[model samples]
Target: MTSILPLILFVVISTVTPGGATTLATASGANFGFSRSIPLILGISIGLASLAAIAGLGLGGLLLEFPSLQMGVKALGSAYLLWLASRIAHSGSPNAGKGLAQPITLVKGCLLLWLNPKSWAVTVGAAASFALLASTPNRLAILLGTMFGVAACMSLALWCSLGVLLSQLLRTPGHWRTINLAMGALLTASIIQTWR
Candidate 1:
């Protein structure tokens, strides 16, 4: 239990941070409400857990050995994030009644984790740091996956709840638009953090 404290702290801090996933979840909650964001929240949690499992299976070592592969992933991830940011920035408010804009889908949410550099970093970092938590890679994978999945779910839900609260204060389309733009900008900024 003493040894596990660091891992728990790491997971909590990483998941609770204001990253791409959290920002998107917040926006989703504000735009569509908590119930509507469930799929996205689940998708992100599952995707991140899967990533940690895969990293435990030596994906991180593979990336270290092949620097070019890492660069390719970064490039692709950056492009995707930029595109997503643009979409978020231009999105209409739910209050606008703009033909009931659909919330982000489960599939997209999962895909976002795969393409998010920050997500990759967290999983890989956890897999590497907590490798000794279990006796074997398979066991490590399970541990990391379960831990990250639970932590991400809780943290993201909290972030989404915050957006729900914010939604109550933002009654106008213009206010929603401003928040959307700010969220979009923050998401874009996170990509810069990843590059750094």
Candidate 2:
């Protein structure tokens, strides 16, 4: 149990941070509703778990060994994040007249996890840091993946709930735009921090 303490701490901090998954979940909850955002939340948890499993299974080691490949992935992830931020910044409110922007789908939510540089970094770090706890790589992967999934679900739900609560105060397009701009700015800052 003590051996797993680090893993728990890592999961809690990673999930609670303002990353791609949390940002999108919050935006979805605010733009749509708690019910509409359920699929996105589920997708994020599953996708993050899958990524962690891959990392624990030793793919992370391969990426670390190939500096160029890792760099490429980071570049791509950064680009994708920038694009997502732009979309969020421009997204219209749900109550906006006809042709309202559609909410993020489950598939997109899952894809976001894959494109998120922070997810890859966190998974790789966790897999490498907690390697001593499991006797076998497979066991380590499964354990880490499960723990991450559970923690991600809980933390993401809280972010979404906070967004839903905030939605109550957002009565106009201007209000929603303000929220979206703030999210976008945070995401952009995350990208800058990643590169630094």
Candidate 3:
């Protein structure tokens, strides 16, 4: 626990960021409810935890050695975020057709996790910090994963509840569209932080 403080701190910071995984989760949960968003949430957890573990184990330094690799990662992250924004821009209402629900799919969830630059950075940072502080790498990885997992869930739940509230209160059809657009914009804005 003592060695994992930095990992916890890193995850808490990222989990609270505007365009983190919680943003996507909230948006999905709002539009389709918790049942439909489970896949996405799980994908985020697995992807983030795995990446964070890798970084904690010394993968980040190796990654940094390759400038092209870093550039590619950034570019991929930016492009993916832009694409998500576009999807939101084009999507119809969650309840557009009678009894129709556009649920969050596994593929999309994977994309959200795999392409999120902020997630990668946070994961790497958490890993690096834990690695530095822990006497054993395995122990550090578990602690980091546990800390991040809890913080991420709590933060995401907050956003999801907020999304649910917004969905119910902002009954106007256009408002839902706006919420989607807002999420997309936030994702786009994350690029600035991720790149820098």
Candidate 4:
């Protein structure tokens, strides 16, 4: 139980905040609806898990030590979030893409994860929980890390569902615009917070 604290902490923080994945999820939900967002969610889970695997394999520690590098990532992530918000703000109508909305493509979803700094942090920090899982020399750690990956994916689904709920509730274009701006600002603020 104690060993899982780091994982819990990372999830709790990243899930609630307006980060790349969460912000994009909400926009995708509002634009494409729940049915369409499924691919996005799946893509995100896989993308993030890939990062987690890399961190588990050892990369985060190197990046984490470089403050400038981390800051650069934050700036890039903030810019992307702002771009996504703009896209949502101009997305025709709240109901424009209903019948003909395209699903969130796997490539787009994966790209979002790669560009998100918060995703990288989560992947790195998550490895801390089950130290044994991160122990490269210990075969047992690899198995445990794999288990953690599964749990993380499940949790991501629940977070994506909240975005779906918001889309259903915010049925008007005005409401969606407000949501877009709010999500955008939140992401920007999160980036600033990271800097502070």
Candidate 5:
């Protein structure tokens, strides 16, 4: 009851923030439309929830114990984000040739969630902070994971919708290129935030 309030607030704030998942969702929606971005949204929601569950199950402590492992994960995630940013920056128009950039696939979306250091940070932090509220760690993890899944879905959908709306304004190739570059910059910023 009262104790769950903080957990809820944490989930809301974390999910609503512009992270890798949200940025990718927006970019996917802008490039491929809402219907095509469904797989990406689903993958992100499922992957994030699973991560939260793992954190609650005490794997997060293992990560904390192994600083080198954590650093490795962060390095991999940062590198992937930089690559994604470059792709976005150079993406072709929506109606371009067959070689135009495609939206992220479900597998890649899931992988991104796993590799995202921010996801680990938020999930592990939430699980640790809210563990005292439940009788068992598993119960706490399940509760947090469920809440995060719902909040993330809503937040991702909102960002995706915003992208779809913005797509209406991008009529020319130059317009799309500019928008893609801006989105790429946003993704780059997310990586920079992780480093800080």
Candidate 6:
């Protein structure tokens, strides 16, 4: 149990911190409510787990071999995140006609992580750091993937719940605009931090 504590800490810290996915989850909760954000939460968890599994299966080595490829990914991810931030920043209140009418779908949520440089970094780091979790590489992959999935589910839910609570306090269109802009700025900052 003691040996697993570090892994737990790492998972919790990685998932709970404000990042692109967590920011999106919070915005979803605030705009669409918790029930509507469930699909996105599940998709993010599953996508994170899958990425961890892939990293453990040796994608890390591939990235290490091709530094240019990694740079390409980071560049593409940053551009995509910038676009998402713009959308969030411009979003109006749910009650207002200017806001997004539909919640993000499961597939979109999954793809978001896949395109996020931070998610890749976290998964690859976890796969490398927790190599001792299992004897075999395949077993380690499964264990890390499962662990990440569970942790992500819990942490992201908490973020979403916080958003729900904030939504209650921010009912007006102006208040929601403020929240959306703040969320977008935070997400943009996260992206900038990832590069540095």
C-alpha-based local distance difference test score of model 5: 0.85
TM-score, prediction 4: 0.72
Point out the higher-scoring one by lDDT: 2 or 4.
Answer: 2
lDDT of 4 by residue, 1-196 (tens): 1465655556556555555566667666655676777787777767776777777766667778998888787777667656665565455445565321465587777777777787777667666545463346243335434543455456556656776787777867678667766765655565565555
- TM-score-better candidate, 2 vs 4: 2
Sorted by lDDT (best first), the order is 1, 5, 6, 2, 3, 4
Task: List RMSD in Å for every model shown.
Answer: 1.8, 1.8, 2.8, 3.9, 1.4, 1.6
Ranking by TM-score: 5, 6, 1, 2, 3, 4
TM-scores, in order shown?
A: 0.94, 0.92, 0.85, 0.72, 0.95, 0.94
- Candidate with the greatest lDDT versus the true structure: 1
Error of 3 at 90 (Å): 2.5
Per-residue lDDT tens digits for candidate 5, residues 9-84, read 8999999888778888888888889999988888888888889988988887777899898899899989988999
**Residue by residue across 24-53, what tens digits does model 2's lDDT show?**
788878888888888889888988999999
Best by TM-score: 5
**Which 10-residue window of candidate 4 scores lowest in summed lDDT?**
137-146
**In model 5, which regions exceed 4 Å deviation?**
98-100
- The global C-alpha lDDT for each of the candidates, from Candidate 1 onward, is 0.86, 0.83, 0.68, 0.63, 0.85, 0.85
Quote the lDDT for 153 in model 5: 87
Model 4 lDDT, residue 139, Cα? 37
**Candidate 6 collision pairs:** none
Candidate 1 residues 53-158, lDDT tens each?
9988877667668878878888888898788788778876785654227777888888888877778878888888888888889988898899999999999999
Model 1 clashing-pair count:
0
Candidate 6 structure quality by residue, lDDT tens digits, 47-126: 89988888887676676678788788788878877887888888998877664677778887787778777888888888
Native-to-model Cα distance after best TM-score fit, residue 182 in candidate 4, in Å? 2.5
Preferred candidate (lDDT higher): 1 or 6: 1
Which of the two, 2 or 6, has more lDDT? 6
Scanning candidate 6 in windows of ten residues, the lowest lDDT window is 95-104
Model 6 CA lDDT for position 72: 83
